[model samples]
Target: MRNTQQRKTEWLNIQWKGGVMTHPVQQDGSSCGVIVVLMAREIMKAFPNVPILQFGTSRKEMANERKMMALQILKASVFDEAENCSMCSLKKPTGSVHRFINWIQCDTCERWYHEKCLGMAKEDLEQARANTWSCILCS
Candidate 1:
């Protein structure tokens, strides 16, 4: 067994290095987050049996998984309803799965809008997560 000081040192080392992880790599870099989700689901579903690292998920399969997940989310969002973009009045954003989540809320009114609907540049709109933003109406 490790001593207290040795354990603490190990913990600090892991934290500094963002914690060690081993997982299957995505062919295309962009699908890492999605792949992680699929892997977690597979782990839960296939418990007792270790998750196969090579589930034969090609880029196309990953794309299909993402779409399926998005559709599932859209159907049953947030306990009941999906938030609609105030500008477009659409529940889902228009674009790829990545862009489907490009929503921002007014710090004042708390209404959500598609980032594109606000006509704001990506850098300009999503500057900082902590930064408070208001819609035109709120402003």
Candidate 2:
């Protein structure tokens, strides 16, 4: 039966009296939820003895930590996916030439490979636009 404002006020009062503090305002509205979750987890991990309400970290520091964590996770996922690929035997292809070419992916194995590795010419790839090319292992 409590109104929203009254509920919020009660919550704030509880937090204030309990020594729980507020995190800084998010710079962007888009990732506020993510920031809050990440900050809470990090704070809990770093300061288990401290009350969460009393624990505070700068928004800049939290954002930087979040960014770095995201990058590390992404890199790890990429590495895992590359390891799963049977064609290159876990070695990612090097050189700008490999980057420029339109790589084909296997439907069955979900592994990616260069046209040259599959013995498919550029013209052949162009000609077989609508056809799905399966890798040799899958074929």
Best by lDDT: 1
**Cα lDDT tens digits for candidate 1, 14-43:** 434466454456677578888788889888
lDDT digits (tens) for residues 78-122 of candidate 2: 455433345554444544345455567777777777555556776
Estimate the TM-score of every prediction.
Answer: 0.37, 0.33
Count backbone clashes in candidate 2. 2
Clashing pairs in 1: none
Supply the TM-score for candidate 2: 0.33
Estimate the TM-score for candidate 1: 0.37
In model 1, the runs with Cα more than 4 Å from the true position are 1-24, 78-139
The window of 10 residues in a row where model 1 has the poorest summed lDDT is 9-18
